[model samples]
Target: MPKSNIMDTYGRFDVIFKKGIGCKLYDDKGTEYMDFVSGVAVNCLGHSNPAIIEAITDQVQNEIQISNYYWNDKAVKLSNRLTDLSDHEAVFFCNSGTEAIEGGLKVARKYGKIKGGNKKNIIIYMDNSFHGRTMGALSVTGQKKYQEDFEPLIGGTTNAKFNDIEDIKSKINEDVCGIIIEPIQGEGGVVCADSAYLKGVKALCEKYDALLIFDEVQCGVGRTGSLFAYKKFDVIPDVICMAKGLGAGFPIGAVMTNKRASVLTHGDHGSTFGGNPLACAVGCAVLDELVDNKILDKVDDKSDYMVSKLKKLKEKYNIIEEIKGMGFLLGLKLSIDVSEFSKRCFEHKLLLITAGKDVIRILPPLNIEKEDIDKFIIKLEEVIKTF
Candidate 1:
């Protein structure tokens, strides 16, 4: 390989994928590989999807993007569709997951000042949660490593233990403005929030006059067999930040706010290219495929099948310590080094993203069939047998 000009931010893999189809990818040399990472759970419908392609092609022929100053048809349609499905009444489109989280925070803080007599600016986040990497989003991200180098983060934030309601309650105060958490912690090893815990947090937020923000950037948009994971848990949040699968790899994100948290007046928050025509059109198409076409209808069944197979593997292989998460955003806790395991899987033409210390994430396309999962299991077995 020639000396690279790209920044060394990412620890990239050796193989450069040139093309991809459903649940599969092709390297520059045309070598086939099964994809379980799904662009870190972005390409929920799979790569080069017909609907997404058609939508983007048609959109480009007409218009791609315009300043948010003027309203656009596709953006309006997408906003309407999202609000209709979600509990929120308003939507703010952005470019990525981090931007969505940042926007949600701004909405929360703005609502707090207006509703809470402008006294509360403090926000609470949970341990092991990954909201995003941007400065505002990073402020709520619970991992210390990501925050170590970047000190003096957005102030008035506290980190509570995941699933520990008392820890959350202990940190809540009169000045608390918002509390953000992931319904399922994606970068934190696919940990799930306890249903009762989430309910308790909701009640506490209500009592404290704080906004509840659900960071569904990784687990939303049919990844967890629902439009959003919070909806599946049946716990309503004041603000919901979503991306990743929202555009099915088209690079779009959104922040939804309920009536109570809709305190941000005009000009409080804005994005130049947020709800651009092209991204919104792709978002609309993805929504259509997931909702109208009933692509997510079979997700629960598929997740069940995959989990059962993983359970069998756990019983047979002692290296398989545990299986965590729900639906397609699953993880395998391994006794062995997951980094090495993932590397070996990559060498074997199977892709897996490692999460946390020893968890291997099993994020496949939402529309992936059981047959593809079976193929994944077969490949996983081969990788383990030699390990």
Candidate 2:
């Protein structure tokens, strides 16, 4: 059969996956691969989870989607659940991480405009941090490569050095509307913000009357062994953008805020597909499993095991520079570029992804089995030997 024609945006991987279960995926020819990428950290509960399947199936049988103008029971339940889990008081659902970011940015800007005037519309973003691909989210993303082609980005965004309190202070001014940061920068080589630095940013934002926003799209939703990454640091942000793992494998996103920061009055922001019934049902199911099933407690144990295994690998292979990050959201800094290493692993029937140029991002399913980890290590060791 002739290959189906489609626009090739992503650098195509040689393997075409046909199905996945738990932490394993099968290619078109039925070759098995240990999936460490987990669709870039979207499958928190792993592939084809029975609970998620049942939830989605049940919701679809009734109402797959409905307009956002009316109330949906699933959305309402999910929102309540989210707000209860978070320190925040309200939730705004959207379709993806970028949409959630757009909602959060709009809320911050509108809050500043009404309270601090239009002059306080500036937003502080961190270098090497990623929010999403939409224009608003992309504007605040500090990576040049992603923003190179998209010139003349939305104005009012200032780049600050991550983990550098002084740099954030230098950027904050009377016009600054909010300070947005990733508590644990997932795409920026798995760098975690220092505790003092995070507290300092919060203090600066408070001093300037600017909102503190945490972009936890990758580090939130139990990925960090906590309900949220900011919670781990003991810092409270005014607004938080979450996605990736919120719905397990379902496409969903949310912008949550405290009472003071929930200033987007009626009609200020809206999404046609946001807060629909189907996604919310799946989200609630995922949250139930994460919370009630004690999945979060296991995150620390899995993370430690993975870290210990990676440390041993590092000792045997001088090519590995460091292993960083918390819980299952980890990255291995390699002395050599990760592109070649990632390709070698894929060839050996393991799926991995590269972050930046030198870091290998390991985002396996939160419930990845011990046996899968062993297989992943064997394949990884073989790839290292090839290097």
Candidate 3:
């Protein structure tokens, strides 16, 4: 009944959340809801995790912000860990996924200029892919709805069909410098690029001397039962854009690059709040939980269990057309209106988010138990029956 000073950017529901722990959220009135959205794949370890809390507390007491002129141990440790975990050799830190996308684009363009000069600055993106909302990211993002208002985007960008290598080849040319894609399209109806298709893309990039960029902002950092989703495809990219789950619930982003794509030198790009001690400390804890605490090891089992139940729900409900995506980043492709269905689920106290127009995205915490998933299935079935 009252309006807040916050910008009306999101079509937010009326509920006011007060607290969260594990896979559940509590509203101001003490009503509990199952949080399957997990901050849209950001809370991989769940809300108020002890590891993350401790990391933040310890870092805050020592150092919160420092000039990038001098190195902080936390940032250095995180960079080393990230580079060690992935195929990358260098890292650039930012504050959000969109910032990460922006940095990756900069690296690609710089590499393009270095490799083939100004003429070879084209970036090829996949249709139905969702990269980010920033100007450069929006430019490469293949969805028209998000870009319609923000036209006159960055130059030399083109779109090719997802999972279509031939179409990608047709789009490629001598001036093309980069191809950026999401290994699994979380916001694009949960579409996944096939293994062969990714391999073909990599081959094409190699042949054309173009950099390959994987936007893993939503599906990376143990969300896909692997450290990186690109690993699942068995085709490595030259650059990886990561953010959502990197800092658990904290805001942090990174652009990692293999030796070939690490073109940016000193003063090429930077962020004042990027790689600050506080955020990198939280990122270290997330990585420790996923790698050392063996949290990533359990993701596949949880994914298999949840997907099985969702498949059964599809069999019973005519509204569900298909179950899409991999690992915790799954989706329900419905014949009904997804936005309305998501709103109904919200009323039912099951927090769900919709992808595109017809898919309800499921992005539960990576550490969520089978019991929580069981509860989600029950709530999902109850909502489906109402249709």
Q: Which candidate number maximizes lDDT? A: 3
Candidate 1 lowest-lDDT run of ten: 110-119
Q: Against the hidden reference, what TM-scores do the models get?
A: 0.99, 0.98, 0.99
- Against the correct fold, how does model 3 do in TM-score? 0.99
Per-residue lDDT tens digits for candidate 1, residues 1-387, read 558999998988888889999999998899999999999999999999999999999999999988877899999999999999987898999989999999989987887787766678888998888887789988899889899899888887888999999998899987898999999998999999989999999999999889999999999999999988997888999999999999999999999999998877788888888999999999999999999999989899999999999999899889999999998999999999999999999999999999999899999999998888899999999998976
| lDDT tens digits, residue span 31-114, model 3 | 999999999999999999999999999889999999999899999999999999988899999999999999998998998898
**lDDT, residue 118, model 2:** 74
* Per-prediction backbone clash count: 0, 0, 0
lDDT of all predictions, in order shown? 0.91, 0.89, 0.93
Better of 1 and 3 by lDDT: 3
True-vs-predicted CA distance for residue 185, candidate 1, Å: 0.5
lDDT of 1 at 133: 79
Model 1 residue 306 CA deviation in Å:
0.8
Which candidate model has the greater TM-score, 1 or 2?
1
Error of 1 at 238 (Å): 0.7
